[model samples]
Target: MIEERGRVLSVEPGAVWVETVRSSTCGNCAAKAGCGQELLQRLGSGGSRGFVRALTDRQWQVGDEVVIGVPEDALVRGALWVYMMPLLALFVVALSAQALGGSEPQVILAALAGLAFGFVLVRWHALRASRDPRLTPQVMGAAGFSGVPLTNL
Candidate 1:
């Protein structure tokens, strides 16, 4: 589980909404230059974000440091989709080409097609994975370290 400190923006019967604090790692990511996510994070000229996650047990109030997570399993599953799919595609294409005596151009096209399809599938899966309730971070306790002072409601 990955943890980040966020401030609670709201609370309901079964969940809490938190405004996430932007991290330096986010700014350092190689894809930050082109991703819409980095652009959104840059909003407020570089400050916090409105990140809402549902919590099952725990009461939160405004100005609290609630920890959130990018669950381990979700991370692993997503990696396989993004990293393994293209390689599998390339392998399948190469084997099929050898069997059919296809031209080099045709074989390369198959690899490229696989790359495109893999990228699309990975992106889709990531979006869905993010919404899983079990994957979210929960409030452990309280701290007086920084940002908003922690509180319970």
Candidate 2:
């Protein structure tokens, strides 16, 4: 299980809302001083708060600290769905368009169209997958100790 500690923002029946800040990995990288990522992190750090809703039976109150966990495999699968699928779709469509003997300009337009279609499909899939319990984070318990920072995904 991948776990992170956060403070409870709110509580509702069978669910709790927790806010987590994304810690920048750039801080540990040698190239951070010269990296665009470091600049962006400085500029947008406050915008990194992500509100996560996790299902739990234990009673929780506002401002209470808690630990949330999600399966590591679920995180990996989610990454593949978000990144790989779109690239695969783009290549498949572009190759198919080329196989159909399209001209250069036509092929370029076809590739752009394919990319847009891939993004649309990703959005559709995300909406459906949000309801999957296996993919959702769970409230493990009250946060009694500090844990590693959570990813913003």
The top-ranked prediction according to lDDT is 2
TM-score for all predictions?
Answer: 0.60, 0.85
Clash list (residue pairs), candidate 1: 69-137
Give me the runs in candidate 2 sitting further than 4 Å from their true place.
44-47, 147-153
lDDT of 2 by residue, 1-153 (tens): 998778788889999999876567887899999988898888986347778999899999888878899999988887888898778878888888899999888888888888888888889989998999888999999777444533322
Local distance difference test scores for all models: 0.68, 0.83
What residue runs in model 1 are displaced by over 4 Å at the alpha carbon? 25-54, 127-132, 144-153
RMSD of each: 5.8, 3.8
lDDT of 2 at 53: 97
Model 1 Cα lDDT, one tens digit per residue, 70-153: 668867766788799767867776678767987888877877776776677677877886777665556555444875544422
